[model samples]
Target: MNLNSKIEMQNSRSSSEICYENFMIFNSQRAGFTIVELMVTLVILAITLGAVYTTFIAQQRSFVTQDQITESQTESKIAFNILTKDLRNAGFAYPVYSNPPTFSGSVVPSENNNAGRDALTLVSGSQQVATLAQPLIIGQNIISITYTGSARFNLTDMANISIDGIDFSVITTCSFIGIGTDCDDNFVLTLNRGMNKPIPAGRPLYALTASTYCIVTDVTDTDNYLDLRRIAGIATLASCSGALPADVERVAENIEDIQFAYAIDSDADGLVDDQNANGVFDPGDYLTPPLPANSKILAVRVSILATTGKDDPSIEPSTKPYYSSGITLENNITDVSNDKQRRNIWSMEVALRNPR
Candidate 1:
C-alpha cells in the first residue's frame, strides 16, 4: 500500500496537470474571427471594387462623346468656309470672261441631285488673264495685249483665254502669245481653240477650270464615312463623277450628306426673292427651285451633316434627326448602326458676288 499506491497517485496527478495545460493553450489560440465576420469583409471589398469600376466606365463614355462632337464641328466649319470662298468667286474673272461662272452650269436642278445627295457644279472664271488692246472679230487669232503686268506671261503658259465670256483655244489650247504691235499692243494672242465670235477691245481674259463638290464613300473602306469630296479644276463636269478623277480630294470625313438650294431673285426685289405660293413676301418663307441654268443666283443655302465615325458603347444618344436653319435632315444615310454615335447638321447662306 505504501510504494505502489503512492506511485500510481503521482502518475495520475502528472497526467491531469498535462491535460489542463493543453486546454488552456487551445483556448488562447482560438481568438480569431467567426465565419460571419469573414463574410462581411469580403462583401465590403466587392462593393468598393464595383463602385470604382462603374465610375471609370462613366468617365470613359463622357470622354468619347465629347471628342466625337468636337471633331464633327471642326470638320463642318472647314468645309463650309472653303465652299463659301469658292462660291463667292464664281463670276470674278481676273481678266473677265464673256462667259463668267454661273450658279448651275447647264443641267436642271433635278439633275443636280446624285444618289439622294445634292451635287454642286460651278464654273470658276475668276482666273488671271492678259488684257487685250485691240478688238478682234470672229475667226481672228492675232490679238494685242498689254506687254507688262504685275506677273509676266510665258509662252509655255498659253492654255486658254476668255473675254466677254467666250473661250478661245485650240485643241492644245492657245499655242503661244506672239509679240506684236497693234492698238496699245504689248503682245498678241494667237488661238485656234474655236473663237468664232467677235471680241471687243479691252476685255478680261484668263485660263479656265471647273470644280464640282459632292459626297461619296470610297471602295476600299469598310465603313463609308460619308466624306465631303470634290473634283477640283477639271476641264468639264462630264469627266468628274462617272469615275472619281485622279485629282479628286476629300475635304472632310464623316460628312453624312451635303445639300444646296439656289436662291432665285425672280422678282428682283433684292430681299431673297421669296416666291411663296401664298403671294405674301414674308420673312423666312423662301424658295428653292428649278433655277434657270446659267441664270443669276443671288444666294445659296447649304446644309451639311457630320458625325463621329465611331459609336459610344455606353451612351444611348438621340435617335431623332437634325434640324437647323429651316433645314431638316431626317433618317438619312448616316450609317449609324447604333444610336451611340452623335451627329449634327449645320446650315449656311452664301451670296454669289460674281454671277455669269
Candidate 2:
C-alpha cells in the first residue's frame, strides 16, 4: 500500500484504541457517592430518628401523668364513700344530747390549726341483735327480749337501750337467763343499772359504737405516707368520759387532707345555723363551746383530698388552694408541701337518718 494511505489508517486506528480504553476504565471502577452527599444522607437519617425518639418520650410522659391522676381520683372516691356511709349511719338509734357528754354525741367535730383539715367523731348503734318483747318499765333492771338472729351479747357486754328514741341507757352487766346454755330465741337479760325511762314494746337493743375519722401518717410504710384512719371505741360511760380506744383501722391510703363542716340547729329551729353568713356552717361555726341542750345535728359536709403517692417530674407544682368551713387551708403554716404529685378532691353532704 502507499505511505500516505498507511499513515491515515494508523491515525484512525490510534483514535479508536484511545476511545475503547477510556470506556473500559470508566466502566471497571466502583460506583460511589461523594463525601458531601453521604453527609447529607446521614443528617437526614439522624433528624428522622430524633423526631421519633422525641415523640416516644412525650407519649411516655402523658401516659404516666394520666395513670397518676387516675390513682388519685380512685383513692379520693373510696374515701368519700366511707365517709358518706358513716355519716349517714350516724345517730342511728342513738340519743341526742344538747350538752352532750364527751364522745357521746351523734356528731362531734374537732378543728385543726390548718384551716381545712378537721377530725370527726360519730356515734352509732350497731345492728339490732334483740328487741323488747314486753314494755320496759322505769327503773327496771331485768328485761325480756326476742332474738331475731345471732345473739352476740355476752357477760359484761355493754348494751344500749334506745327508749322512745330519746333516752339512752347502758347496761354494764348482761347475763342471759338460761340454764347453762347459749342465749338464743327469747331470753332474759339482767342489767347492772336500771333504765331511767320506760321503753315501749318492740324497741330495739343495740351495741354502741363511737368511730372517729381522721388523717394520720402510716408509720408501717417505709415512705410514711398519710392514711384515712378510723378509730373505733365502745360508747360506754367510761369511754364517753375518757379518751377513745385505740382500735385504729386504715380506711384509705395516700389520703392527704380531710375537712368537715357541720349543720347544726343550735336553737332547735330545724334549720342550719349559718353563723359565718357564707351560706353554710363552715370553720367558725364549728362546735367550740358545748352546744346548747336543745341543739340538734342536721347534716354534715365532708371534703377529702387524696394523692397519687408519688411525684411526677412532668407536671408543674400544685398551686390550688384547699378550703374547709369557709376558711382557706394553708399547707405551710402547719404541714404543707408543693409536691408535684397529682391530687384529687371529693366532697359530699350527708343527711342523718335518725330523728334529731
Top candidate on TM-score is 2
Give per-model TM-scores: 0.63, 0.68
Instruction: Give the number of the best model, judged by lDDT.
Output: 2
lDDT of 1: 0.59
Candidate 1 off by > 4 Å: 1-31, 94-97, 100-111, 125-158, 162-189, 192-206, 235-246, 267-272, 277-286, 292-294, 313-340
RMSD in Å for all candidates: 9.1, 7.1
Clashing pairs in 2: 98-293, 282-325, 283-325, 331-336
User: How does each model score on lDDT?
Assistant: 0.59, 0.66
Q: Encode model 2's per-residue lDDT on 128-150: one tens digit a residue.
A: 67778889888887777776676
lDDT of 1 at 215: 73
Candidate 1, residues 129-248, lDDT tens digits: the string is 566678877767776666434433333322444565555452232224345212223435566443678777777666555557777776557885667776654423333243423247
In model 2, which range of ten residues has the least summed lDDT?
323-332
* Candidate 1 global TM-score: 0.63
RMSD of 1: 9.1
